[model samples]
Target: MDSDRIAEIIIAEIRSTVPELEAQPITRADSMADLGVDSIERSEVILATLEAIGLKVPMVQLHGPRNIGELADLLHAKSKA
Candidate 1:
């Protein structure tokens, strides 16, 4: 999938999982914490995003993407693999 589509999915998941973040504008540079996602909510978002895209990423691999853009790139790469 393209990065834009991946970003859309991530944003959608964030909106669904984090109620307070629903009205905020999320961007590539924004970290999960910046969207008011605590560690636990971060995990929930990650898992939900993975499930939404039908991808199974290792937890270790998931640790590296600190921002939405990076996470989208990672998911795009994994989806291709």
Candidate 2:
């Protein structure tokens, strides 16, 4: 899927986990800080997203995309490539 669709899914996941958050688009470069997601939360997100995508990405690969938008972009690119 494209960025917008991917973003919606990511946002939903984040909202489900972080209920206190105001929903935002994961379609673009929204920072991790903007989502109120700290490192611990990101770890959970990493596992969940990987499982959803059916990919076993190395943790190092994930490290670069330190936010939902970046993560989504990375996943999309990886799938496309």
Candidate 2 weakest lDDT stretch, 10 residues: 22-31
Clash numbers, per candidate: 0, 0
lDDT tens readout by residue for model 2, 4-78: 666666776666667777555453567666667877776776677667667676777767775667778887887
Candidate 2: lDDT of 64? 79
TM-score of decoy 1: 0.91
lDDT of 1 by residue, 30-73 (tens): 99987778989888888888898899978668888889999899
Error of 2 at 16 (Å): 1.5
TM accuracy, model 2: 0.73
